[model samples]
Target: MKILDRYLLKTYLITFISVFVILFFIFILQTVWLFISELAGKDLDLMMVIKFLLFASPKLIPMVLPLTVLLSSIMTFGDLAENYEFAAMKSAGVSFQRTLRPLGVFILLLSLCSFFFANNVIPYAEYKFINFRKNIAQVKPALAIAEGQFSDIGSINIKVDKKSGDKGEFLTGVTIHKKSSLGEGAKTVIRSKKGHLISSEDSDLLQLVLMDGYYYEDITPKNYKDREKMPFAKAFFKKYNINIDLSKLNAKEGEDDEITNTHSMLKISDLKYTVDSLTTDYNKEVISVADNLYQRLGVTNYYQVDSINPKKPKTPELTSFLNNKDKFRVLDVASSDALSSKQNLEMNELNFRAKKKDINSHWYSIYEKFIVAYACIFMFFIGAPLGAIIRKGGLGLPIVFAMLIFISFHFLNTFGKKFSQESGITPFLGACLSSIILTPLAIYLTKVAINDNGGVNFDFITEPFRKISNFFLKFNKQQ
Candidate 1:
């Protein structure tokens, strides 16, 4: 290898590694802060906490790696330009393109690595991370009850305004909703001024003791006409004890083997399989709904009538078909059928929309794997040329430029994904939106760098205004 090539590669690698570590650390801290509530009072051991963070950290790579590439490219090239090393290289007959050759090869390899990581490691980590959370909640039922949010532990949904104690055993302003066995929803509501949670590792029950509470149970009347009254029984109590069964809350052995079916947890091959199945199911459902609605509305009877008599009207008016009394009866029955069909169609439309969104989500996930890989190369082009043109390096200006560019990219990416998920656009377009929007900028920067333009020219914009001002000024002077 030539000395210049080696030198450039070395400088870039050093900067890349340094930037990656710092950024990764910062993101990990952010992750910790984001999930602090889930981890704070859960009494998780050190190993479990580390495992949680470890599983989550892989997901950050798609965010961190591209930014690292951009920042490092800008910093490396910017520093060289600021130090006049680029001038020396230019004088020595080394072109700017030649300087980028070595690092470009490295970036190509890194992109492949990024693709592999996204396709395999990230999905696996997502699966494990999700399962870990579920296991934690099951193993420690107390962790399920977070303060200020309703938490479903088994059949009961419990909410607490405040919790204080060594293990958050003391609760204040407790509200409990017990779901009925008949699937009638939460018919029984319990409100308490204070409550205490008691549980043991060896036992299969969590005991909740409420003090100064009110119990309200909704009563369903036998007569359908009286149901509108919404009668309920209420009673005040000084003390109440409830035993919540924890048999199912105990984490069974090999529970993680049950795969999580979320799109994020699927690799490319799995995603393709899922998308195909979901699409097939969606098409079948649409066909079934259409056929059912066709039958329900009696459209076939009209066709049959037309087949029997060619002269019969295919769509007869209401008055032409029957006498006054018979017409009224038919109209009432038709109205009822139409109303029922409308409701059915509306419900099916919502289901179809939801299913389509799910399919789109899977498609987006597939595209995202490739997107992360390509983003590395994309950011590098933008960063390397931008740094050369700006002639600034280090943490000050490069950081600002990197952040603005990356923030724009991230925003467009998020918007596109969300919009695509809602079926506003195709998944492919959504995944590639940021890249499409920024391609021209990368090209412009590279062109300016190669042509020695120093920076973007504002002459066209300024010269027009200048000429206008001069024309006005000359007219005024002549007058």
Candidate 2:
């Protein structure tokens, strides 16, 4: 390699590594803060905590890697420009584009690596992370219930005012709401002055022992008039025992892949397969529902009307051949059927909308794997050119510029995804929205930098304000 190319690559790599480490550390801290509720007071061992962080760290690459590329590029090129090294290189017949070639190649390789990581490592980590959390709750039943807020476990919601003991197994002021099998909400409520959680490593059940508890069961009477009484069954107990099954939460020694169907846990290929299957199923469901509604509404009977009768009006009015009583009966039945069909259609519409949103989410996830890879190259071009144009270096101005640009990109990306999920736009467009909006800016910066144009000019903006100010001053003098 030429000396100049080696020098530029060395400088860029140093800056990139330093910036990446600092940013990754900061983001890891942010991740911890974000999940502090789940991690804190859980009595997790050091290895478990480290495992949790390690599993979560892969997902942060898409966010951190692009920012690192942008910030490091700006800092490296900005310092070189501020030191007049660019001028020396220019005098030596080295163009700006030549200076970028070495680092650009490095970025291209990095982008490829990012794509592989997103397609393989990230999905695996997401699967492990989620299942790890579930297993934690299973192995340590007390961790499932956080003090002062209700936590849903299995078919019951449990809340406690205070918890004390080695594993927070001793609870005070415990409350439990058992969900009804009939889908009528929580019909049974249990309150205890104190409770204890008992579990064994070998078993898949956690037993709750309550002391001095009251049980209240809401009763619904069959008769409408009797229901107005608002009846309920109440009983007081000195002690009670409830066993919660945790078989679903069990995680084998080295395999925690129990829950793996979420969109984020699927690689691009898996996501494509899921999307295709879901779309086919959705279309088939719509067709089946339409056919069922048509049959239920008796539309076929009209088509079977006698076509051979010459005297029969082609479009005879309803009740033309029926008595008044029969006509009224038919009208009532028709109105009821119409109302029922309307309700059914409305329900099906909501179901279809939810399914469509799920499909869109999967499609967006497929695009996002590619987006993360491309974002590295995208941010590099923006930052490198912008750094040369601005001619400032170090942490002060480059950090501000990097943050502003990245924040805008992140915001637009989020907005587009949300809008697309709601059916406002296609998933491909949503995933590429930020890049589409910012490409022109990168091109402009690169063009101006190549032509030796300095930082962006605000003359057009300032000139108008200056003219308005002068006009106001002259008017004031005349007055």
Per-residue lDDT over 1-479 for candidate 2, one digit per residue giving the tens place of the 0 to 100 score? 99999999999999999999999999999989977867886667898899989999999999999999999999999999999999999999999999989999999999999999999999999999886776676566787788899977778999999989887889999999999999999999999999999887767688999999899999999998998898999999999999987743333333432243488899988999999999999888877786677678776444433222213224535558889999899999999999999999999999999899889999999999999999999899999988887777899678978998999989988998899888999999999999898888888888888888665863564477579889999999999
Question: What residue pairs are clashing in model 2?
Answer: none
Give all TM-scores, in the order shown: 0.76, 0.79
Q: Tell me the deviation in Å of residue 337 in model 1.
A: 1.4
- The clash count for each model shown is 0, 0
lDDT of candidates 1 onward, in order:
0.86, 0.87
Off by over 4 Å in 1: 145-261, 301-321, 455-479
Best candidate (score: TM-score): 2
- Candidate 1 residue 184 Cα shift, in angstroms, is 14
What local lDDT score does residue 398 receive in model 2, on the 0 to 100 scale?
86
Residue 23, candidate 2: how far off, in angstroms? Answer: 2.0
